[model samples]
Target chain A: MTYCVAMRVDEGLVFLSDTRTNAGVDHVSAARKMAVFEQPGDRVLVLLAAGNLALTQAVMQLLSEPAPEDKPTLYNVATMAEAARLVGDAVREVHRRDAATLAEFSVDFNCSFILGGQIRGANTRLFMIYSAGNFVESSQVSPYFQIGESKYGKPIIDRVVTPSTPLDEVAKCALVSMDSTLRSNLSVGLPLDLLVYEKDALQVTRFSTIDNDNHYFQMIHRTWGERLRQIFGEIPNPTWADPANVPLRARETVSNVPRVTGSELRAEPDTSAPPFQTLMQPESGQSQH
Target chain B: MTYCVAMRVDEGLVFLSDTRTNAGVDHVSAARKMAVFEQPGDRVLVLLAAGNLALTQAVMQLLSEPAPEDKPTLYNVATMAEAARLVGDAVREVHRRDAATLAEFSVDFNCSFILGGQIRGANTRLFMIYSAGNFVESSQVSPYFQIGESKYGKPIIDRVVTPSTPLDEVAKCALVSMDSTLRSNLSVGLPLDLLVYEKDALQVTRFSTIDNDNHYFQMIHRTWGERLRQIFGEIPNPTWADPANVPLRARETVSNVPRVTGSELRAEPDTSAPPFQTLMQPESGQSQH
Candidate 1:
């Protein structure tokens, strides 16, 4: 398991990936999942990968070699779309070479990548490449892509980020997202590789390798939880006292009892009975009463 | 699909379940996923279920009826463990009656439950019963059990609740957790059932079927996000300027260039190269520079 996320905001792009890889719990190890193709003054491409380590490594190797004949390589792709296509094609190449052998072992050839960066003359872009080598680009409505163990970290991003978010803010959001993922999931571990690409910079300018000790990340890990708990504490406990709480009204209407004490009677409503009394049991099973 | 969570806390127990059930995205409808078996001052068992609606409903039917011969029904179960085992046995009974037919249609015999309450003499307990007729009890260290679409809502519970948490606060935490699940997953939806059990009171005293118009819940849905985004915005953005961020130092140590421009040479440990620079590609592919 892995967790990688990339955001394309108005000012730039932000990428973060966890380094832990494991064939199983016993085989856990650290492997850098971020690859920076920094071609200063021309283009900057950031690739964050997750899934089978061997498969990702093989795809990366294939990406580095020359593409057949005039096909574009990552280093020379003129547009971000073409660059995304180049990645999908490389994934397809690895699938063609390895999928059958992997199937023999019952491993589903699972691998995914988040590719995001800028090509000079084009706006920053983000794309998520799938195991099947098909891909989807990020849009203004959803200007981000997450691959692997995504849900635990997603709500924060959904609430905090948008296309116009500042580049540095996006980076912070990514780290907070990663913090949630790391705490909830054992498969995604540190040190993390983080890269913040300024829009149109055409270079890898802001990058960090955040380990457990990185001061800012440590601060994030501590403060985010403390603040969350503080916020959680401040939210009022849900009140059953409110009239809009139907079950309370139903209980009132159904005399003083909280139990429906009969099976499926709500479907055949008694005008005298409340609108909802759903917890059901057979009348014979009322001995405890 | 559904989301049901039960927590055992120092004050008592908390149960919350979303009513939405779906055959697929197109076939969504609402069904109650929570069942309350209150024997007044004797026992108050709450069952929260998720997975195949048919399987869960069938299991519920089996649980509602008398067990064959002298076997105890949930109404007669002497302990919370016995109640959990009864639930599991009921699940296996459903599987026996339906699994083969379901398999013919390629549907898994999937269903699970969180059973929690107090049985007069015992302390408040929570157990998760799985599809295979086995169950595990929650402990003081991990006081909650969530079934179906659990991950999206787990991190918050992990951070906020404990066995020592107050019952009302646990209820609030459960709702907040459900809010996260409902926002991140479409399968978990509105009109939630929330039941708060007091330690030795045993009868269902606080229960609410919370819907869209429920004032407290509407406040939660609005305030949780606003406060989260406020808290998120308050956190400082990550800085690559921090020297503790190794990638920044690596660039300084490896001359002014940001690209490594060659294959996996970091292993050779050029003392000149700052300890970690694993992103690699062939030297021949440096044309973009």
Candidate 2:
């Protein structure tokens, strides 16, 4: 499993990925998931891959083959959208060749990619390419796309990132999101690839391979959790001690009584019968009343 | 879809569940995911369910049947473990009756449950029951269980909760976890059912059906996100402008260069090539060198 996230913000695009892969829990290894195609002044394309390593690596090999004059390649694609379509074609090409054989062994031809960068004529762009060889581009309304183990890291990005977020802040948010994923899931391990592209620069300016020692990531891991606990403490616990006076208590009639079957409990909670128990005796009959 | 979580702390047990159910994204409604069987002084059993609503509702219907003198039922179970076995039996019973029928329509016989409460003679115990009617009990090492749309809400609980956490604080953590889930997943919504049981009181004490209007839950929904974003701002962005002076930069030789295919890019990075472009012209050739 892996976690790859990329966002297209006003300033530029941000891409981050983790490098852990596993055959099962026992056979885990580190594999870089980022591919950079920099024509410096002309274009800077960052491709992040996830899913079956063999399939993705195969696609990478095919994409690396010298461009034929008859068709388009990542190097000569006219637009970000064209680069995406070429990636989709490559995925379909791989599926046609290897999927059926892998299917005999019960392996699905699964892979996905995030292609984002600037081409000479266009602004920064991002697209998520799918296993089915279809792709979707990022828009102002939805500024990001995440593939692979995405849920744990999603809320932070959902709350903080937007098309207008500054490039540096968006990069910070990606690392923070990755921090959550790393903490919740061991399968998505570290030594991360981070690339921040500046709009129209058409070159990679900020890139880092973050591992156990990357201080920014280290600070995020340590401080985010600590500060989270601090705020949790600061938020007053729902005052359940005295429901009658506690504003946070559900003051309405206790209509949400959990479905009580045909036990002695009831069709309705006798709210007035016994609101709570302070102490109990073995012979307490009203306790069950 | 639903989100239900249960934790056994030293003070007692905490259970929180969301009530949203959807057949697909188009058809959505609310239904209780929690059931309580309390013979008060004798025992207090709470069941939280997730998965195909039809299947879980069937399990609930089966569990609600009148207890016969010939066999054990939730109403008469002597121990918390026995109660869990009874719930498992109920799940298997439902599967035997409906799984094949559901499969005819390509519907999965999917359902899981978290059961936590106290039977008079025992201390509080928690169990997570799987679709196969198999189950595992919570231990001091793991102290909690969550079923359904659980990932978005997991990291906070992983960081904060423990067996020694106070009952109120544990309940607060459960709400916070649910808050994260609600924000991230539309499938898991409110109003929520929360129940907190005391270690020896052996009866329901703190229970709330928190909805959009519930102030405490509203606070958690509002404040948790706001504070999270606030703290996100406080965390310094990774300094990437000048890697030469930044301690956090990956100073050691970066053996982790992403697999570059056969483009003009070479096997070795020309480290001496001009790094990071501040300004560039269309004729900049070294930018790609």
Candidate 3:
């Protein structure tokens, strides 16, 4: 499993990927998942991959090799869309060659990629290429794409990112998102490859290979969790007994939960059950009443 | 799809479940996923279900009806373990009757449950019942279980929950966890059933069927997201150029990312590329150097 997230905001594009790849819990190794395509004054492209390491490596191998004169490749694609299409084609090509062989072992041909960059004359664009070889580009309403172990880290991104977000701020959000994923999922490990591309730079510029020892990432890993707990503490705990409290009030209209008494097989209305009580103040002797 | 989470702490047990059930995205409706079996001064048990709504409903129906004289039932179970075993046995019975029929339609006999409660003279216990009718009890190390659409809501619980956590705080954590799940998944919807069982209470006490209008839940839904954004803003954004800064720095020992130049098929080491630059200060004009 892997976790890779990329964002395309008005300022530029941000790409981040974890390096851990595992065949099983015991067979784990690190492999860089981000590959940059750059031409100092002409174009810059980045690809972040997740899923079966073998399949992703095969696709990466194909993309790294020179293409035939008649074929499109990441190096010469005229626009970000065409670059994404070439990637999709490469994925399909790999599937055609390996899917049947892998099917014998019952391994699904799973692979996904986040492709984002700018050609010399084109605007910065971002896309998510699926296992099926189809792709979708990011839109104004949805300015980011995440692949693999995504759900644990998604709420933060969904709330913070937008097209107009600043480049550094986007980078911060991606790192924070990765920190959450790393904490919750053991399959996704460090050292990370982070690349922040400023639109129109037309070159590989701001990039870092982050390991556990990186002080800045260490700050994020520690501070984010501490701050989250702090904020969680600050949010007033639900006050069920007091309706006038701003945080929470147990209203009369809400229905009571049904319960089956020990003497009955089916749920029976227990007239003795209270409509509401504060679970927060269990020591007060009022919660169980 | 559904989302249900149950926790066991020193104070007691907490159970929360969303009411949404769907055959598909287009076919969604509300069905209470939580059921309680209570016997004042004797025992109390709560069951939360997720997966294959039809299969879960069948199992629930089986448990609700009177059991044969030779068999155990929720009402007569001698201990919490027996209650869990009866629940597991009920699941197997349902599987025996419906698995083949569901398979004929290519539907799975998939259902899971989180059962927790206490009987007279026994410690409160929690168990997760799988589709196979086998169950595992929660322990000190892992004091909670979540079923269906769980990942989005998992990080918070992983960070905050412990065997010693207070009951109301656990309840708050559960609500926050549910709020995250609800925001990320459409399959888990409004009108949640929340039940908090106090240790040794031996009856139903604190419970609520929370709809969109429930003030406490509304506070959670609104304030969690707002506070998260506030803390996110407080965290300093990454500073790329300064290794001395607290947030991030490019280390010297870390290898540079490989790049494929537009004019080259494979990556080439470009010594010309700058080692470090500030992506955060795009207006500084030093980033492109």
| Fraction of native contacts (fnat) of each candidate | 0.29, 0.43, 0.59
Residue-wise lDDT of candidate 2 within A1-289, one digit each (tens)?
A: 9999999999999999999999999999988899988776778899999999999999888787765566677877788898999889999999999999999999988899999999998888899999999999999888999989999999999999988899889999999999999988889998888888889887777777777765667778999999999999888765544333323222345434574744432433334333532211112222321
DockQ of each: 0.26, 0.36, 0.46
Residue A98, model 1, lDDT: 93
Q: Model 3: per-residue lDDT, tens digit, A1-72?
A: 999999999989999999999988999999989998776777888999999999998999888876667677
**Number of the top candidate by lDDT?**
3
Residues A1-289, candidate 1: write the lDDT tens digits: 9999999889999888888998889999988888877666777788888999999999888776644546567776778889889889889999999999999999989999999888888888889999998899999999889998999999999998988889888888999999999999999998888877878777666666667556677888999999999999998764444222332343333222234353332222223322222222122222111
lDDT of 3 by residue, B1-289 (tens): 8999999999999999999988789989988899888767778889999998888889988888765666678877888888888889989999999899889999888899999999989999999999999999999999999999999999899888899888888989999999999999999998888888889888766776777666678788888999888888888787665322434434444647566543445355445654444333333322323
Give lDDT tens digits, candidate 1, residues B50-158: 9999899898887776445466776767899988998998898898899999999999999999999888888988999999989999988888899999988999999
Candidate 2: regions farther than 4 A off: A241-251, A259-261, A264-273, A276-289, B241-251, B255-289
| 10 residues in a row with least lDDT, candidate 2 chain A | A277-286
The superposed Cα distance between candidate 1 and the true structure at residue A195, in angstroms, equals 0.2
Q: What's the TM-score of each model vs. the native?
A: 0.87, 0.90, 0.91
Clashing pairs in 1: none
lDDT of 1 at A80: 84
User: Which candidate number has the best TM-score?
Assistant: 3
In candidate 1, clashing pairs total: 0
Give TM-score, chain B, model 2: 0.88
Q: List the residue pairs that clash in candidate 3.
A: A216-B247
